[model samples]
Target: FEAGLLETLAPLAGVAVEARVASAPAEKTRKARFDEAMLFTHRGLSGPAILQISSYWREGEPIVAAMAPDHDVFEVLKAAKAANGRQAVHTALSQIVPRRLAENLCAREGVAGNLADLSDKALRRLDQAVNAWTVKPVGSEGYRTAEVTLGGIDTAALDQQTLAVKSVPGLYFIGEAVDVTGWLGGYNFQWAWSSGWAAGQVC
Candidate 1:
């Protein structure tokens, strides 16, 4: 586990979506992105995509989610409108995202009624809602449920090649104890093994 899962204050507890999510853009914040599954829990957001971006997410910043990552949402909605103008807006959106989420988003965005009644601008707004939904996370699960902790002994204090403490000759910091952190996959495990091996050679 690590200390990098996000918690949201929104009413999205039971919804899950496969989205391409990105950390908020800012001058000093490193924007992290992931295209994977995300679950809306009673407390906040979780799952692979949320966990990956949490490392780069800063407090008070909004994260962006591309709900229909593989499709052009505007085009889809427009096409749906053309195909069957009587179809409900949210119903058409459900083709892109989960049904619950589609309805929720449509409600939140103040878009409703049949697609035939919607203008090009209205469709664009729905596109933004589907493709670029941004939510500000209240906080994170912290170290308790985190996949791996983020900060550690600064890499500058250690010899990169050997993972040895530059100032303390025999001392070495490896894996999660060092400043190196990988994504949700096996990179962190590999780091632990590789760093330990590098230090083992001469330590």
Candidate 2:
């Protein structure tokens, strides 16, 4: 049995092939835990916003993205007033998000206390915070569970027209495998389509 095993392995022993393995260095891979909430200012997600921001994510940095719209607190207050008509604007805003979040936001805007006590100035502040609520995301789930990887093959190594590797011929990469990643909405899909189309046309 030993002779037969050696005989079978003889052919494999002579085979030589180069194996390329890529891994993040220990320092680059080490993860730091962060406890903070990430916030977005717009009305929930408008599709591509999250994706665009994530495309620029860097390792080791605590992820917190925010946007403040031009309109201030008064806008939110007025809108709330219109929606609720006679109902309290703060009460109306509270119904949209968690009661606790609403309360905190209102408090930060000095619109807390009793709804009856809300002044025009306080209402304005509430409106601004809501419309431009400084989102604080309590960190992301980390790279292990991330949906899309941000960086990869540098674009400088690929031909913009054909997406062919400058150094390697008949070798092409596209989609998430490549460096270019689209925004969360349909941007990624568009990148897939474009990159795939380029490679298909060339290769």
Candidate 3:
């Protein structure tokens, strides 16, 4: 929010960023949505991962994010230290994530000096920072920017084969009107097509 550097851009556009989404609070591990663009908005966060979780985002809830979910940053750093102890720690880290991110994380974590000199404990802390960065938002962007609506006529009230309301002979809820919603990568469109075709058969 301060720098305004990473706003509404793709994940691969510049500095590499791993976006993890945790819709549930009691869950052990957050659902990781990697390689997606995450934006910092006036309210909180908006992007593919944020939007996908927003469909399930409840009020007074928070979404957990991990910057690097793919690998164990601590192990990677330790391995680098064993192999090339003379090299700068940040330099070794740059190979894992984006260089800019590696540098910033290294500085923030106070991970300086030759890897051989750094303790295993310090490396573990840095690993948590890189892979377990969590954020809590006030709320989602809502209907104005939501990708798809999550609810409509209840599934129990409709005929699954034809998508016709049980009580109503002619009424049909197809496409976005039904309760089906999906993730960021064009699943809702597929739902719309299938539901429309289903209703078309009955109509």
Query: RMSD, each candidate, Å?
Result: 4.0, 19.2, 4.6
| Residue-level lDDT tens digits of model 2 in 74-104 | 6555566655556655566655444544555
Q: Residues 89-171, candidate 1, lDDT per residue (tens digit)?
A: 99999998888888878887789999999999988998898888888777787778989778899999998799988899789
lDDT of 3 by residue, 1-203 (tens): 22332342223244435566566555545333435655544445667766777666666655666666778889999899999999888888887777766776777678888888999998897788676765555555567776788788788888999999999889999888877777778898998899999999979
Winning model by TM-score: 1
Candidate 3 regions exceeding 4 Å error are 1-14, 18-21, 27-50
The TM-score between candidate 1 and the true structure equals 0.88
lDDT for model 2:
0.51
Off by over 4 Å in 1: 1-12
If scored against the real structure, what TM-score would every candidate get? 0.88, 0.51, 0.72
In order, what lDDT does every prediction score? Answer: 0.85, 0.51, 0.71
- On lDDT, the leading prediction is 1
Better of 1 and 3 by TM-score: 1
Native-vs-model 3 lDDT?
0.71
